[model samples]
Target: MARNTERRSALADAGIRVLAEQGARGLTHRAVDVAAGTPRGTASNYFPSRDDLISALVGRIGERLTPDPTRLSSHAARTPDRDLFADYLRDVVRRLSTDPHVPLALFELRLEAARRPAVAKALGAWRQRAFEDDVAFNDESDLPGGRTEIALFHYAIDGLMLDNLTAPIDSGLSVDAAIDELVDRILR
Candidate 1:
């Protein structure tokens, strides 16, 4: 069972790389097999159809993007202040900037989701998980506005991340500064 889990994880990672490099049109069982460096037919054995593979890939991306509970707990325990929240936002921006492929693949999946119902369903669930996590984090930190604040925060961060990833220009303000400004506006 563990071996199967590992293999599935490897295939999912390969699928992400393929999606990043080749886009949705290029994501296929055979392509994933080649990217994974495994024998041919491995991806097919795990994910029987394109929708299945896409679904798995969506889950995999969520896993990569979401902060672990332990990390969240440690951060909250250390200092549940606005500064810590700003630091968390900075880390999020840093990950998006440094690991461009992950977001690139995610964007591809999002575009694909428009045309594929299964992919759309997976994305919806993934988004819900993120929303829930944000709510929990806000509650734990004793932040105001509850879900409304989280909704705005997510929208702002999404825009910032998309802009930063697409056309990163030195606008005199660092990413950290931008995050601080946004967080302040949202939390205030």
Candidate 2:
């Protein structure tokens, strides 16, 4: 069991390193094994299937990169400060933008999953779970086309993150302005 854990950890680290250098499309079990200083056969011993390896790599990447929504929820509950929620989201976006490797890998996985129903299902579940609690606070209860408004809100925030990734130095685009516009238009 200890050996299995060690190998898994090593493989994950190797995966991250290779992903950093070569991006997700370049990821291969043999490449990870070499980066991990393990025998060529070791990766297959640990991950007999491509899906298993990709799943593990994806999980590891999420562990290292994504913000924990539970933490955000707990913090917001404890503080009762709306600004804190905004700050939390801002920090999460900043991390996503500045961390080029993880964001790029996640983008790659998302694109790959587009044609794979199972992968898309898993990714969708992850996204829903991550954002559902915060999204509940969005107050789209009575507006006309509320569902479409909610979807557009999500789309705008995602677009902001993409913009941030490209222009990491200047995100003067006010999140406050975006949120206010959303509230005025969608929540009225």
Candidate 3:
């Protein structure tokens, strides 16, 4: 049977919520069905297997975390400089933190990947493509950084998001200040 795109998206989103709240072990098909408010086996009917469900989650997270194209293009039109880079990074973080469940579920999947190769395989490929897309965007926009610099920013941004979502080491520390510092030190 042909799967409904909307239903699949909803199920995957529900899976994200389940993963965020209950971790990988709790992300069963029934759990996703419950989260989506669908009948029993709805998620399984759509996904067919756990791996398929995970692949859908990875795809949906990419959609959720993607930068808004309007904002992205406006930033791209800016004169490339450290300030612009910092602003771009700020937007990236804002998108990441907009939905608490998206990042929380992402971290949960990353941790689960250590034991489940299926998760690793799906997430790894998705992350690599995302990295390449970032590099391409930076290059096309004349952003003040090379691929290595972009990689460093990615690492820093992930750490910053993790801190914000989980528990901050210093609650009073300024994320903006940290982003500025990263741009100042990494870009120029």
Which predicted model would earn the best lDDT?
A: 3
| Comparing 1 and 2 on TM-score, the stronger one | 1
lDDT values for all models: 0.82, 0.63, 0.91
Sort by lDDT, top down from the best: 3, 1, 2
Q: What is the clash count for each candidate, in the order shown?
A: 0, 0, 0
Model 2, residue 156: displacement in angstroms?
3.8
lDDT of 1 by residue, 53-152 (tens): 9889988887787675676676767656678877777766665666677888888888998998888898888888889987986787875547887788
Clash pairs of candidate 1? none
Model 3, runs deviating above 4 Å? none
Off by over 4 Å in 1: 1-3
Give a tens-digit lDDT track for model 2, residues 59-163: 776666556667656654554334443455455566666656666666666776887776577667766665563455443222133345556655766766656
Candidate 2: misplaced stretches above 4 Å? 1-3, 20-24, 66-79, 133-154, 166-188
After best superposition, candidate 3 residue 52: deviation in angstroms? 0.4
Model 2 steric clash total: 0
